[model samples]
Each structure stands twice: as C-alpha cells, then as structure tokens.
Target: MRTFDVPSAPAFWQDPHSFFSSSETAQGGVFASGDGAVSVLGFDALDQLGRNPALDGHPFPAGGMGSPGLDALLRWGLFALTAPEHQPLRRAVAAGFGARRIETLLPLLRRAAVEHCREAARRGQADLVHDVAAPLAGLAFCALVDLEPLQAGALVAAVEEIGRQLSPDSAPDGTEAAGQQAEAVLEMLRALEAAGASPLMRDIAERLPPDTPARPADLVAALVLDSIETMTAGLACALDCLLRQSGVAEAVAADRYGWPLAVQEAFRLTSPVLLTARMAQADIAWQDDIIRRGTTVMLWWPSGNVDPRRFERPFTFEPLRPQARHLAFGTGSHSCLGRQLAAMLAEELAAALLPKEGQRAIRIGETVFLQRFARLPREAPIRFA
Candidate 1:
C-alpha cells in the first residue's frame, strides 16, 4: 500500500535490474505510484494478475498525445481493443499467420537472412542493427503482409517514427510529425488494399464477420507497428549475447537445435519489451488495499524474468536453463501473436551469421540502453572474418 513515485529517474533506466532485485520491489510484488498507477513485479504475480478480468488491456487515452490523427490510429490498433471485440480480431490476425503460411515463407526468410549475413561477411565488419537486423525484420514483415521487399526500408522508417509517440517521455510535439506518419501509414494501407490485399490481410478479412468493425488493413498496420521494433531488437540482443558469452555461437553453429535454447535465453535475459500496461476496470482488492477502477497497472515483464525467486542465478545467461516461464512474449490472450515467426527469423539469422568454421563477430562497442530496452547503436561495428 506504500505509494512510491514511478521510476522515471535517469539512474533507474540506466540500471533497472538493481531496482527489480531490491527488497523494496520484491516484498509485496506491487507498488503504487503517486499518480494512482500501480506497478506489478515478478513472474508469479503477473501470471495471477493476467487472469483477473478487472485488469484489461490498456487503451491509448483520447487527446493524451495532442495529435488526433495519431491517437485515432493507435486506438484503432489491436492493442487498444478489449474483450468481445478483441478476441475475434486477435483470432483473425492469428489465423493469417497460420502454420502453412509461415512454413511456405520459410525459404524466403532463410534467403533474406543469408543475404544480409553474407553482406556483413563481405564487409568483414558491419553494424548488425541497421545492416542486418532491421532489414531482416522489415523484409520478414513485408513478406507476411504481401508488401514488396522494395517497400521494406520506407515502412521500417515510418514505423520507427510512429513508435516515438508511444514512449513515456513522449510529449506533444505538435501534430506535424504524428500526422505525417499517420498519412504515410494510410497511404501504404490504401496501396495494399488497391493491390487486392495480401493473403494475410485477405485471410483476416475473410475470417472476421462482414459486420466486424475492424478493417483488414488496420490490423496489418497494427501488427507492423507493434512487432517490427521488437523483432529487430531481439535479433540484435541474441547476437550480443552470443558475442559476449563466447563459444555459444560456435555451439549453435555446430548444432542447429541449440538455436532455440540460445534465443530463449537471450529473451529471458533481456526482453525486447520491458513492460506492458493494463487498466483496472473496477475496484479490485490487493493484499491489503484496493486498485480502484480506471487505475493504470504496469507489468514490468523483464523484472519478472529476472526475479530471484523464480530462477537460479537469474542474471547469468545460461542457455541450458529451462525457459518455460519467462514473460518475454508475455502471457494470456494478448501475448504476442507473431512469436513463432519472430523466433524463426532469429534462428535463421543465427544459422547464417555463424558458420561451422569461420571467424566470429566481436563487439566493437558496448551495448547501449534506451530506457530499459537494449537498443544497439545505428553503427555498433562488429568485425567478422
């Protein structure tokens, strides 16, 4: 029941693990910020909280961003939808990425990975972030949505611009930036619709009832906006883990099966997504107090993965450790729908980047942190042989 201000200090972002590991956060597993927002920590606690109906997926608050166009686009996206409305849309989107669809795209995904990795090898030194991870994510996303590979760079750039509006530090920077990004998305969606829609978009449209409020293009945009950054960051993180840990890359290179374990461990150690927000729909009882209706609940996911109670040597990156309970892709109905595709891309990239016998990549600079997320620099050079 103690009210602590939300952790927004620069120092906190610089070192979130310290706060998560402290007794203060671990004691009750929940802390209330002065603004009535509640932050829930730990894997077990979040698993339990996710099942409670009172806390539903959060929506982008109207007028909060000072850009009506941007706010509208965000609100209409899948992340803002609730129950009844949310389930059908979610199912439709999931169906679009069905096993057959991804399986068919496997060769293409592998080819893209190989191409990027080959280019990195040609240079003998490359920035995996922009040169490899970003393009891989962008191209994979394009393939999923039936967009041309040529559009990948533009789409990726637009999504990055859109993402800036979602950050906690985001402030009203006038409507110009948000509006431009919104228009760019609308333009792309219109083009896709004109081109008779991608198979995924068509599947989504066919699956939903004619009366459903969501447009197929909106769902595609939602997926792109929500997933691309995470995918790019995840690949970069996994590579960073391999480079820092030593021998892991060679182990994976020798046995493709090890890719899953290494990728999962990377996710556990540094989740691309640090937190998710839920809104309390009604007054709910806590251990000794109440979460009033309309209060925002923050689920610090990375903290849960690193919780001392759940795993032995939580901070250490042990690829062999069981990864069953990590909240990397989150839990419950809103868990990542594109997780399979994301994992496949990472595995394929790893396979291509590390050969059975070749010089390995060495990090040229320290990994950078953007708030709680592990974001690589635009050019975090890595030498390869």
Candidate 2:
C-alpha cells in the first residue's frame, strides 16, 4: 500500500476531487495520509463505514482534529461520541431543531433575508456570507440552540473566529484567534445565565439523566457553536451554486417545490463539511493490508457525494435527480440530527433570495473558500436589483 501523503491543510482541500481520485486509484480506496491518518474513498465505502457499528464517530475529547479552545466548545457536548454515549444528548438537542420548531423560526429566517436586503439597500453591495448567511445562521442558532438571542452578535464573531481553528495553520493546537473567540462566546453565555435560563436550556437539562456525560452548559454551547459554523457554510455554498449556474437556477426557479431540491442538490455538490473521521474498533481487512483496531479512518464525504457511479453527471447540479440522496449530513447513529432543520433553513433563504418578478438575478462576486471546516465562502459578495 502506498502512503497517501496529502498534507493536512487547505491546499489539499482545494481540489479534493483530484486527491480522491488519485488516492483511490493509487491505493484501491484506503491509504495513509501525511498526518498518520487512514482515509477511505468512494460512496459505497463511506456509507458502509458510516454504518459500521465497530467504528466510533467521536473518538476525541475535543471535537476531532481541532484546536484546544475551539474544540472546548464541545467539551461538555456529546459531539465527540458515538451512540449509547451520545444518544440522550443528541435527542435532547435534536428536538430543539425539529421541523416544527424550524417552522416557528420561519419568520426569523425570512427576517434574515429582509435584513440582507436592507443592508444591500444601504451599501449598494455587501458580502452575502458575512452579512446574509452568517448573521442569519448566527441568529437562528442563538434563538433555537442557544436560547440567548441577545448574544447573537458575539456568537457570530465567535463562530467565525473559532472556525479558524480548523485552518491548516492551527491544526492540532488551538490558535490565539480560536482562544479569543471561545472566550467571547463563553463569556456571553455566562452573562446570559446570570440573568436567567431560557426554556430551551431547561428542557435540554431536564432531558438528560443525572449520569449523562455531557453537562447542560456544554450541550448548550455545543449546539450554539454548531448552529453557526457549518450551517452558515452550507447556506453560503448552496446559494453560490445556484447563483453561478443560471441554467440550473432557472430550472429550479420554475418548480413550485424547487427551493429545497436546489438546496439538497447544491449540498451534494459542495458538502460544506467534507470529511468525518471514525476510529476502528476492530482489525479490518483491506485490499491487501490489515487495518488494525484503534486506527483512525477518515471518510471523505465530498468524494462520495460526487462519485460518478452514485451520481450521474456527478459534477452537475441537477435538482430532483433520482439518486439525489447524499451524505451531506452523514448517516446512521451519528448523523447530523439537525439535517431537516438545516435543509429547511437553506430552502427558506433560497426562496427569499431567488429572483422575484422584474428583479435581476442575484449576482455573485469573488469568493474565498475556507478549505477546511465547511469549504464555506469566506467572502461571498452578492447583489440583486
């Protein structure tokens, strides 16, 4: 087996397709990366790994492969564990982001779009990511997950700053920016607690048993941190997909139920959160090698999401594609509990931002991809008239 020496940095993430293909062709689906990590490619392989009861999704104290302070956000959260250990907290947090609850948040979601429009009106140009997607995601997270809407501005900053913890430069150790961001978010939450606890927080606490591994505050903080980072990335990238492809956008716009389809399709393409790592619980036989137990296995979802065998015209964004079910949110016990809510949020924003009658198609300016984390558009300037 050849060593897959892809560096653990943004440069490799820049073209995961090339890496996936080269790695797969070179090693027949499994190889060792430069970071001493084992990675697997292909849609079938990823799905099988995701459902492998032997592999653990959360195998780290702080969220896997992240910096200390940034990962500390999930220190009390269940994000770093698989089933059995993670189930109770997952259920508790899932309810808060349920579809019905999301429906209640429709007004806030629409308000985010309205506020973006207002910002554009004032400046004639603005970053859709920072101004529209990030703030919208931040506020939604604040109300639904944090239950502390007043700290939204700080949450936005913290989420952005902490997200940098995933950058190649900060890998394996928390960066100074990450520490500062964590301090900001935690301080804000601490202040909010001094005032009073919201029903959402209390409900989450009540749901967990006395012996639960996750503390109530950790659960709240984890949910808050997640709500902003990846959600914001998914929203920004999905919109970028539609805005850049007029043919696909027009097709989606023509359908009454197209917004969600567009979101799902774009999700398959970008897969904002690209790779998820799992630890093997038992020795597994690979093509010609033995994968020892306790070895870390990286499931590259972006590769699977665009696997030609699974997705016809894998590179194209085709809404309502029959084989459209993708692993943007992963699968099995550790799947993203907020999948439905995330989809709803994206669809709502798409509906609001999709070109209206007599209005110009939304235009996108230069974009900067995060490379790590969600591959999100760090700077997505956009406008419509």
Candidate 3:
C-alpha cells in the first residue's frame, strides 16, 4: 500500500526477468510507480485484472490517447472501445478471425512462409524479424482484409517506421516526435485511401455503426494499422522465443502437433505487449485498496508471466509445459481480435522454418531490442544450416 517510484532502469528493459522480480520484492503485488502508474504483479492479480469489470483499456492523457486526431479512430476501432459500444465490433472482428477464416488462409500463409524462408535460404542469413515476421503480418493481413497483396511491402515499411519512432528504445524527442510518428501512422492510412477502398473496407463498413463518420476506407485503414503493430510484434516475439530456446525447436520437430503449445509458451515468456492502461470504469476495490474512476492503472504483464507462485521456474523455456495461461492478447471484450491469426501465423511459420532432418539446426543470432519499446525485439537474425 506504500508508493515506490516506478523504476525505469536499463535492466528493466534489457533484462526484465530480474527487473520485475526485484520490483515484486520492493513493491509486493501492487505498488504505485510515482508517475501516476501503478503496476499490479503476480498471476492471481493478473487474472483479476482480466475479469475485473471496472478495469478497461479506454486510454488516458498519459496513455497517449484522445487526441482530436484519433477521434474517428477510437470511435470505430476496437482498441479504444468499451462496454456496449465495443461488443459489436468485437464480434465482427471475432468472426473475421474464426477458425474457418484461419483455415482458409492456411494455404496462403504457407505459400508466403515458403517464399520468405526461401529468400532467407538464398541469402544464407537473414533477419527473421524482417524477412519472416513482418512479411507474414503484411501479406496475411492483406489477405484477411481482402486488400490487394501488392500493397503489403508498403504496409511492412510503414509499420516498421511507425514502431521505430514510437518504441521506448527510440528515446522520443518529446511530444513532437510522438506527433510525427502519429502522423506517419495516419499517412499509412492515407496511402491506403489514395489507392481506393477494397472489398475489405466495404465489409467493415457493414459491421460498424451507420453513424460512424469516417468512410469505410479511412476507418478500415486505421484499424488495420493498429492490427499491424500488434501482429508484427507478436509474430516477431513468438519466433524469437523459438530461436532463444534450442530445445524448443527439437520438441516442436518431434511433435509437429505441439507447435501451438510452443507458440503459447513463447507468448508467455517474451510477449511484446507488456503494459496495458486500464481506466477504472467505476470505483473498484482491490486488496483493501480503492481504484478511483478516471484512474489509469498499469497492468505490467512481465511480472505476472514470471510470478514465482505460478509456473515452476517460470523463466525456463518449456514448450510442452502443461496448461499455459497468458495475457499476450489481453482479455475481455478488449482482447485482440487478430489473436487467432497471430497464433496461427506463429504455428505455421514454425512448421515452415523448422530445419529438416540431416539439415543443420537453424542458427540464431543475438537479440536487438526495439528502441521505442523495450519489451519488443527489433531484429532477430537467423542462418539456415
């Protein structure tokens, strides 16, 4: 119940496992980071954070939301919505990511993976982050949204530039840098608009409320950018996890059916999305403390994933670990709509990238953290043997 200034130490970003453990020691399961951000640690607290009705991802001033520029975006996008307004969009997005949809896209996913991996083979060494993860998100996203696949490379570039400018590793110059990155993300949408709306935009328009102000292209373009950020980072993280754990690839190879579990375990350990701001929908009591409405509490995921009380040796990579529980895609109505696709992409990519028998094991290079976000990696290079 006491306040400790949030430690923004370098170790917290580069070596978070120890950093978060030290935070648990210093602040217990819940403590306020003097910067008006309170981190809730531990697996139990995370479960509560997920189910707690009073907590939601509505964003706040400190959370980098509610700019006049983002009005149409938040109004139409699932990332910022809450309650009744969020339900419809959530269902629509969910339908888009249904098992059938992912299954239908599997062939295309495999084709794209083959193309990227083949390119990596030709080069003998490639950054999987760029060659594998980014293209996977770009091409798969376009296919899902019914957009022309030709625009994918541009989306990949825009998403990367946007991520680079916005990540914590970038050491943002201040509000101006953020404003610039924000404009760049919007420009990605403009680029999409200039090319004209595809059937994807029309489908999204049918799902959104008729009163929504933005045209279908404008709204869908904004939403796809949001999806691109999360999807790209997530695929990169999952693949990076596989590269980090040598034993994992063997386990995956032994039981190709278990790639899903490998991907799940990967998500548990090094999720790109570590911090989520949840505004108190109403005054809510937690562990004898009060969370006031308008309060933006931070749900720090790294602490929860490694909470000693839950998984034994939480940091150890265990692809076949029984019963994985993670918040990589968040929870509740605000949970990621493209989550299944991300997982599917990860699973399929693992199958594609797995080194075959008699072939040398894939060699992994060192990790480079994204400048704008410490939790996410910037590049993961690999050399096929």
Candidate 4:
C-alpha cells in the first residue's frame, strides 16, 4: 500500500501531482492510502470515474447534522425556485449562457475591463483580486443576470462568504455569519419575485409547466448565488496564473488573440473548484477498487488538469495548445451554466489590465485559494508621457 501525508487543509491551491504521479505508481490508481481515497489523476480516469453517478454523486458536500437544516433548506429552496423544474432549468440556463450571448457581450465587457484596469494603473498599487478581478467578475455577472451594480456587489460579497464557510478551517462564527448572509440573499430574491422586477424571473415564470411546483424566484436566486461564487473564484485563479507566467502581461498588451487563449490555458491549469463530491447510489467496481453503495467519491479536477498522461507539459502554460480539454467548469449534467460568460469576463480583464506597455509588476498578496481574498496587490507605476 502506498502512503502519502495529507495536507491539514485541502490543498486546492497546491499541485497534487507534485509529490507523486500515477505513472510512478505500481498500479494505475494514485491511491493515497493515508487519505483513504483514490485520486483520479488522468483525464481518461476522471472522465470514467468523475461522472459515474454510482461513484461521484453530487458536487456539494454532504450536509452537517443539526444546522437548523440550513444546507438542506438552501438546496431544496434553490431547486424549487428555478424555472421549468430543476432539470429543465439547467438546460435552458445553459442555452441562455451560450457562445452567442458571450460573443455579444465581449465588446462591452472589454471596454469595462479596460477602464477598470486603467483606474487600477493610476493607483500605482491595488489589490488585483479585489480591485480588478472581483469587480469585473461581479459586473459581468450582474450584466448576465440584469442586477444593479450595488445589488451585484452585495450578492458577490454574500456568495463569497458562503464559499469561505465551506472551508474546513472556517471559524464557527464565520460559518454562522455566512449562513445568515445567504439567507438574506434568498430573502432578497423572494422580495424580487413578489415585486416582479426581473425579466429573467418573469421569463422563467412563464416557461414553467402548469403542474410544476418550482418557482421562478428559487431558480433565479440559485443561479445568481452560484454564478457569483464560481465566477469570482475563476477570475481570481486566472489572474493568479497571469501574474505567475513570465511575459503573459506583455503578451496581453501586444496581441489581442494572445489574451483569450492565455485565459483559457489559465482556466485549464488552475481549476478553481478543487474537488466535486458525489454519493454512490449503487455498488460499483472501479479499476481494482470496489466502491460500495453509499460511499462518497471526490472527483479531483486540479489533479486531472495536471495529469501528464492527459496534458503534455501540463505544468507549463501553453496558450496555443491545439487540443485542450479541461474540467474547470465541470462535465456532463452538472457542467457550469455560466462557463462562456466566465471565460469572456476573464479574457476581457486580462486583455484590459495587462496591456499598456511599461506597466509595473502585478503582485498578488494574501489569497484564500477557494475562499474570499485577504488581499491581492497589483502595483504599476505608470508614466503617461
């Protein structure tokens, strides 16, 4: 049995295959015997194991007991709120967030991103995560959801807090605070439903089957919350990659095509969501391992992204790689709804901020990996002459 020490906290930020690669293992499986779970390290392995409903069940972690049933309530509430039932809502929302919508928004998004970056440049030093990425992502999400600026910011903060609370190391008080914030956001959505202010909600209301119990408010609220949380994390991860890669900043300035491809590579490399969890519905044998019914499986996307078998020179950033298949937004039935929008926003921000020749170093300060940012400093001493 192979043994590896597990990090105290989930090392979503760290490269998991750094210590050991599946090629090194005697058998195909990257078994962390100490961690008591099999690591799906390759894209093929991930494709087979990650989406297996019997193995990998749902993305959200199983709820903790005795929390006023807050997690369950939130899940059910979201399911009840989106339009055309849960499954249909997923399909329609995906359609709405298609390539067409993203293409249309590119110009406007690019303008906003550039202006924001210019403002940051003038400041000499700014938190890239907070000042640039966060705001840009929040605004992009708002545009997609038709939310007002101030309301979008609030929603961003609340969703960020929820992500923070999911961390194993979060303080009890902080977790409680996040729950309250999420509840408040839900209340706001409920109020919006009552007032009939949002056209998206109205569209959903009109689309639902006559017998469906799902409400438009529930769907809208769930999408809003999910979009802000995931998009913000994606933005931060993309910025971190841009800062780390040599010449990427200058490349963004020089070539328009460079930034978009670079953003895609970054997304492929630094998958913001570390692992997705799923509960087993039936007994299954995966490779040499037997996964019994009711066992929880974790599909590790970060590990899969770096798997050498799947990605050639996985650690190296190759913007022009011809074939790049990444699970950053997930796969199959649970794939992210805002993927195109998220990609557009990230690309636009990179193009805007990294351009303008002779900009100073973009520094990243303390960041919480998958949680809220403590600080992200992007300093540039600009000479307008």
Give the per-residue lDDT of model 1 (tens digit) for 1-385.
Answer: 7654667776665456666764655666778876779888887777777667777778876776666657656765665677667778888888887878987888999998887888788889888788888888899888888888999998778766766666555556735686688677767976796688688888888888667877887777766777787787777777766667767776775674488787788778766666778888789787776888988888777778788788889989787776545777677777777777778888888777766767556777766555534333334568786
lDDT at 344 for candidate 1?
Answer: 87
lDDT, model 3: 0.67
lDDT of 1 at 73: 60
Q: Would you list the C-alpha lDDT of every candidate in the order shown?
A: 0.74, 0.69, 0.67, 0.62
Model 4 vs. true fold: TM: 0.81
Q: Which candidate is the best by lDDT?
A: 1
The best candidate in terms of TM-score? 1
Q: What's the TM for model 3? A: 0.85
Residue 35, model 3: lDDT of 54
Ranking by lDDT: 1, 2, 3, 4
**Per-candidate TM-score against the hidden true structure:** 0.92, 0.87, 0.85, 0.81
Clashing pairs in 1: none
Worst 10 residues of 1 by lDDT: 371-380
Instruction: Candidate 3: give the clashing pairs.
Output: 167-372, 167-373, 168-371, 168-372, 168-373, 169-371, 169-372, 170-371, 170-372
- lDDT per residue as tens, model 4, 1-385: 3443443434423444454365633354444433344444556666766565455324343466224324633563322222224466554455445566567767778888878777777776666667766777778766665667667678778766765665555567676777777677777777877887766667667666577655766666666656766776787778777767888766666664476688889988777666555545578676766766655445566666777777788889988776687877766455566777878788777766566565643654444443222211222122211
User: How many clashes does the backbone of model 3 have?
Assistant: 9
Query: Which TM-score value belongs to model 2?
Result: 0.87
